[model samples]
Target: MTTAPPDSHPPAAPPSTDVEALRREVATLREESSRLRRMLDTAARIAWSHDVRAGGGEPVAPAWQAFTGQSLEAFGNQGWLTVLHPDDRAGALASWADAVAAKRSFSTRYRVRRADGVYVWMLAKGTPVLGLDGEVQEWVGTCSDIQDQCLREERAAFLARAGELFSSSLDAAATLATLANLSVSAHADWCLVDLLHEDGHFERSLVVTADPAQLPLATIVRSLSPVPRDQPVYPPSVALTTGRSTLVPEVTAPLLEAVAQDANHLATMHQVGMRSLLTVPLMARGHILGALTFIITKSGRHYGDEDLQFAQELANLAALAVDNARLLQGARDAIRLRDEFLSVASHELKTPLTPLSLKLQVLSRAVKAHPDSPLAPVIEAHVETGHRQVRRLTELMNDLLDVSRISAGTFRLQREAMDVAALVREVSARFAPRFALEHCPFTVDAPESVPGCFDKPRLAQVLDHLLDNALKYGAGTPVSLTLTADGAAARIRVRDGGIGIAPEQRSRLFERYGRAVSERHYGGLGLGLYLTRTIVEAEGGRVSLESRPGEGAEFEVMLPLQQA
Candidate 1:
């Protein structure tokens, strides 16, 4: 070889044999094919080839036959179409026909029966295999398992809808009925919600079915008394008793017999056609309120872990809604009863107070008439003390009446042109004797006249309450009232040198029954500031407080000069 000419290069080693080159190419192709098959298997995708022109073709993909468990001969005759869900067949075929006519890529989603006899969602996509002339020769496609993804999306949508229904209102009966109806429409053929009452009794709160004709049969099923919790055959009872979810994948005749209460019950159960059931206890705040039962009928759907989880989520929402409604109703009833009691008590107390006031006035006059008598001073002192006590009772009765009126939505204001300065002076004079008794020095600063359209009696009441508050808590310290008019509003501030409120207590001081002091030390209902704030707000005004512990507190009221 070395002796040959440099240009020849020893015949180039026979050009590397045609058979060896072909073998290397074949090996490369085999490796690529194996990689593609691995990719398809890992992705749960089955590839198939169909000859549209011939209407059918022999199964060429072992994956397809393995996935559907179809024999080669059966698959050749298009037996795979039989595995498609009955409800989806018509639409799927129609889409395929359209895609074939247009000679374009095809994509669709449908439920397909698996080798295990369970239906799973699949996303099928296909592309036309074109020949050299750009005419379609056949179709190549893939079927991918999308069951988990579809179920997740479905569950999310269902819960979102359930949340909307639950938030619509705090009415228990209406909301539970809506929830039952929604369940039947989305996930169940029938839904029954049974609630456990406080008296340990069970009541079927709602029963809804998808088919209108089945309403009578549902009613019959509802009439059948629930099975005892000791018997684990009944799902609802089991769920309610254990406070856990129960799922019955399939309902058998023997199981139905075990759950039935009587012959009529068994007959009704058969007529209702329950195929599967899921029950979840309605849990709220660590308590089980009830059980929500979901039943499948002719749809032949089965309840699985995913269905149970969804039902549990729905039940949680339902429980919260029901609990909230019940709490709200309870509060309303309590308020109503309190208002009624206040109205009657105020009226009854007033009835006796009027005559007592007259008697005290008569007694005072008689004692004054006998000024020359030896017992004149003692009798006079006793009568004055009695008068003070009577006045205090009257004030309390009036406050109760006002609260009742407000609660009943009957509180009204009579606005009239009046001198606020004059009203403030009158209230101050009325409270003068009380301030003196408590040894609290009172001072008032105001203009001679501040003209405004306001509710006179209500304003007087507000002034009286503020002064009394100062007298009670001021503890004989100096109290001052300052009044000023500024730009469409009247500002009145009462500063009291007494046991000042803590910063934390100020926010709660304005709510009904909110108090910063104990009843043992303070001798009035905790309604004064609440009533004051309510009146001020109703008149387009505001009230605020400024104070620190052990420092004097100043309460301010700003009222619109003109009534709305």
Candidate 2:
């Protein structure tokens, strides 16, 4: 080797310290490059750099491949442009061109096709590199996936639109129809509404965008279920009862399999290609009124919390609208009935008045003609009977007029400072004779002084109705009237030991035209308690009742006491 020529030995002669230094420098550069690559990979976005003039560049960085599942050969040399959404292509290219011409940073949001062929929103941003002469050199940019953000925005928009539609209409049918149409537009396959009846049964009120045949069969089957007369199948009823939304991912396999095995849910699911369902409760003032069911069929999409919340809001609006419509219909019906009743009542009242006036005139003439005739006593008794009948007719007319006034909001109260005790005493004295006539014992308990500001005539009317109801329904049982003062309030309670009201009917007893079935047998208009409540409330007071079937009923009136 020592004897070899310099040419053959080549670099062996330059075994110097600089060689080790160069090796160290190269190793340091390699480590730096690896560190930069890892930093880019760890970032949420994928990075790329391209020369504007060359129109050719290195393939996408490793991060780009990881994000899009595409290789360098597939994306380099403008090949990656194919992955952009068709709708976004023109805008994206225009943005890039503007950025290049202006020699400034560029940023834009557009849609890109993923490896699975699903278009997803993405944000791309880049800054231009410049040479010493200020000419553009290259563009370095990143693309960040924003699909989740875009979907959230879309969902928010859909909910806003739904709110606008539901809140604008009061027609129950139109509202339900709008809801169904919106559901369909929002990608639901079918929607149906079921309303609960007073008898605790559910009846299909509307079916939107659902198969016609399925509607009839579904309703018939639901009506025939063994659960109860007014209850729906378990899942739907549970949602209604609990006032919560229920989501069943696979209804046929898990939910329907348990209770409604023979239900045509499986066939319906196949026909509609449904895989998930949502049932939302419709409630107003804590009472379950109905339910709305939405089915997702085209795609087996699992409904999430967001979807449930949206559907629940829609159901809530629809429920309120339906409840309002029902109330309006009830009011119209009440007015119609009231008109008819008034016509009949006017005719009956005239019949009694005519005879009453004639009897009084005859009595006056007979008394003037014979001063000592034996027929005087008989005439006097007959005149007294006529007077009682006339009084009864007058009371009936007053009750009807009071009801109408209360309904029209024209009933104004005349407030006066009075002793509640004295008023109660006066009403008790007046009712004492009637109680004796009916052979019903009556008792009164009161404080020496129960001062309150109240409407005297209205209060008297209320007491009279309470006493009459107690006497009529008490079935010869003792009736007790009590008056007391409790810290800034006066309390008057009338209790009767008679057939009491059912617990279920107590809530509606004070409502207009509301009466217990037991009370209906007593043969009177159902406006007594309604008028009583209206008068009490107008005077800034409240009335409540407590009773149980076969145990007697207690009615309490509370009025604010006058300040000392």
Candidate 3:
């Protein structure tokens, strides 16, 4: 009835009792395989294999192609090496080769390239799969992206160290020193700082080379001799001038020659082995204050845009730190200037008193005749001097009052008939002590009487400035002061043996804050000559100078007999 009549087929095999169990086992294995693939996807890891005998390598599973977004053809025999960063390639390969030959486990970390040409940190690990008889059959490996974790940790650590260095001191120079030391092994081998002066000029402020061999070169460039002041060129100069960033991937002979101040400089560059350079202008509030330069010397490292970007960021912080330190130093300098002026003013205030004692000699006879010790002659002679000194003291309140007022075009003068010769004599006697201290022989020549209608106090100030300038710029040479009268005016001449003035500076000699000498060699407010000219012109007089470098300088002033 159940088709049993169809006995043509052989006897049907009995249904095994293990059939259902076998089916269950197969289902379990399928579930496990799916779960493993899901796990691989979630971990961002891809499996790969290499058959030593077959002489080829490929992804053991499709996960590698999916994760890397790369085609099989693109992943050549040494595809892993192609993704390895240049800096880490050699070490990574060496490690892998050793492991593959020994048929052992291996692990390493390095930057790997993605399909889009981006590089990232990756942890690659592999193990050898053995065949029968314990011989090596194939090698299995996995690749995972660890770029984010590694970069995050590294950045956090570096920033923390950098923050500590920056906060350690408010001194811009000191902070830069620390930065240079810390960055020598990491950022660059040499660090340089160029600072902008208030006059809109640049000077090398600092140079540091971690490598000892380059110290001499750094010294020569920074101290022995400096860049030409006339040329406003170079990478740092361009960056500062344009307020942008500049990069020099390789330091060529022509580049070195162009920047070299002399043959010796070019030779020094050869000894230093300069390779690459990064120049970033220190900018704040829309103005370029200076430039920070980082150089690769002896390291032979390639600096890319990201490197430049990081350098610029550090430069920004450096600029801020430098500005902050400068501000603080300025405040301190202001305080120091105030104190110095106070001391100088006090000394100057006392200086007039000594000259008054000279007048005392002239008043002795008259004073002796008065029964009450009249002291009338003394009082009469000193009345104007005391008033002038009092006014001079008032002028000291701002320390720069005279210069400021003159520059602001709000200066005024009071005139009277004064004996020019007598005032000159008094001032010369007052300067005797200072000249002696400088080992300078000073002489004064004046007629017995040279009368003029002038402001005595202002004339005294003018003489003081001229004399001070002569002594300061004299270079320890003799100074001479001469006064003579002409047909309509009285002339005073101050000459000194000093590093003299250049012809170009003659026109601006009397300009306010004009400097005819290097600050490293001479220092002042640059207001002395200007003040002399201003006061003399206000009194219907004129000022002039004559000089040549290494010869000496002579300053002359003319005072009209009549008021302007």
Candidate 4:
């Protein structure tokens, strides 16, 4: 064999052989291209291209048949337009026209009806190709299915607006009306708000119109109850009583039969067109204030937990508004009562002051004229009684002024570091003589070195009021004053073996003008405990009480220890 030399080059292939190799390579390229085409054809989404100016060039791409289950010829010359929803057709066309006119990329989302009559949201995006001269040549695009995304966005927007409406207004009636309007607008249904009356009944206060004129007046009149709780069927009284949200779907024949016994059932059914009902209890401070009822008329749609929860939230806000309104009304009534009391008190004080002043003037002259006579003692006694009356008047005026100052946030405290034990002992000793006069046993237990920071005058005033209460209420019973301390705080407890407070009255014990029902037995303006709480709280301390009916009451004041 004539083998080539180690350094020599090999002979070149013949032209025929080279041609055959090139042919094989071209065949492989063609096979690969065919495989890629098959893959694209199998994709769910259709890929397409179009010339901007040449509108009807290639009727439909091959991929359209795979995606839509239709032949390419079916969409000849913009025939795909027929598949667009009528509501979306105009907008889609306008958008395409605008994009072509501006020579810009086009992107849009719209609903397209499939051949099977199912509508789906489609997201279409296409970019216009340009020549070197900036003239539009061809366009490339893809269509993606986005039905679920669109629905979610729509629901989210509805929820956001509903939340805004629920939080924006503080008037229950206005809020309910707004909620009704929102319900009708969002769900495209008739809405109703039935508020529970104090007498345990449901009254429709607000109605949103789907068709106001067509609403059956007789049906509404008959179906609604001024006393829903008294009825046997479709009653909302239980929900209102328990403060719960209730949903009733499609008033079945049995429910209708049960409610038919009531005269209002027919009228209510007619008025509300009630196919489904959702009842939400409006509650304030754990009590049922009312009920919010929504009636859906157009469809037999059942209210789900989500719908009930939303309604409940609205009801809760409405309940707060209702409570606020009630509080405002109560305040107005209290102001009126306070004004009347002030007028009466002013007259009473004036009546005493006139005689007191006259007596003091006469006694002063008489005492000067008969300084050594026995008549001086009689005049002096009369003078002292007049002075006591004057002092009482002064105290009433001071109490009223102090209350006003505290309410206006202008009350000032003169704070000082002092021995709390010493203060307690001094106050107790002062009250000891009073206890002796009343024949009541008194005890004081003051721990040495119990120091705290507080306003001495204010704390003394608190102690005076507490001792007064003990004397006034614990007549003929033992009263105790005890001072105790922990590392961080000091406490002074004044307890009395007096008539204790009722459980129901304890919560309002510190509220201004709050007096127990048995207050008629005690002579006071009801400002003592309120003032005490205010003074203590201002010094960064707290006052609390422990007692039960028939047992003695103990008032405990805790003050934070000031760092040395």
lDDT of each: 0.85, 0.75, 0.76, 0.72
- Which prediction has more favorable TM-score, 1 or 3? 1
RMSD of 1: 7.3
Query: What are the runs in model 3 whose C-alpha is more than 4 Å off?
Result: 1-122, 126-139, 142-160, 199-201, 224-233, 258-261, 338-564
Tens digits of per-residue lDDT for model 3, 458-538 = 898888888888888894799999999975988999999988889999978788778987778776767677778888888
Candidate 2 TM-score, true structure as reference: 0.49
* Cα displacement (Å) at residue 112, model 4: 8.8
Q: Write the per-residue lDDT of candidate 2 for residues 1-564, one digit (tens) a residue.
A: 458866584455546688898999999999997787667556646778787668765534666676567777887766777888887888888998899889999899997776655567889888898999898877877777787798778767876786677668766777777877777666476776777766886666665654565566445434432232144455566665666677776656455555452556544444555567888988887888888888765453567677788778777777787788777778888986886677568667777687777778788687758868888878877776677667667767778777766556677988888888998898899878778888888999998877778788889999988998898789589999998887778888999999999989987878877878745467677778988888887777899999989989999998877532
Top lDDT model: 1
Candidate with better lDDT, 2 vs 4: 2
After best superposition, candidate 4 residue 259: deviation in angstroms? 4.9
Task: Give the Å error, residue 439, model 3.
Answer: 65
Q: Among all windows of ten consecutive residues in candidate 2, which has the lowest summed lDDT?
A: 221-230
TM-score of each: 0.77, 0.49, 0.41, 0.47
Best by TM-score: 1
Kindly give the number of clashing pairs for every candidate: 0, 2, 0, 12
Give lDDT: candidate 4, residue 246: 68
Per-residue lDDT of model 4, residues 505-545, tens digit only: 98787988778756667887887888999988888889999
What would the TM-score be for candidate 4 when compared with the true structure? 0.47
Range of the 10 consecutive residues with the lowest summed lDDT in candidate 4: 226-235
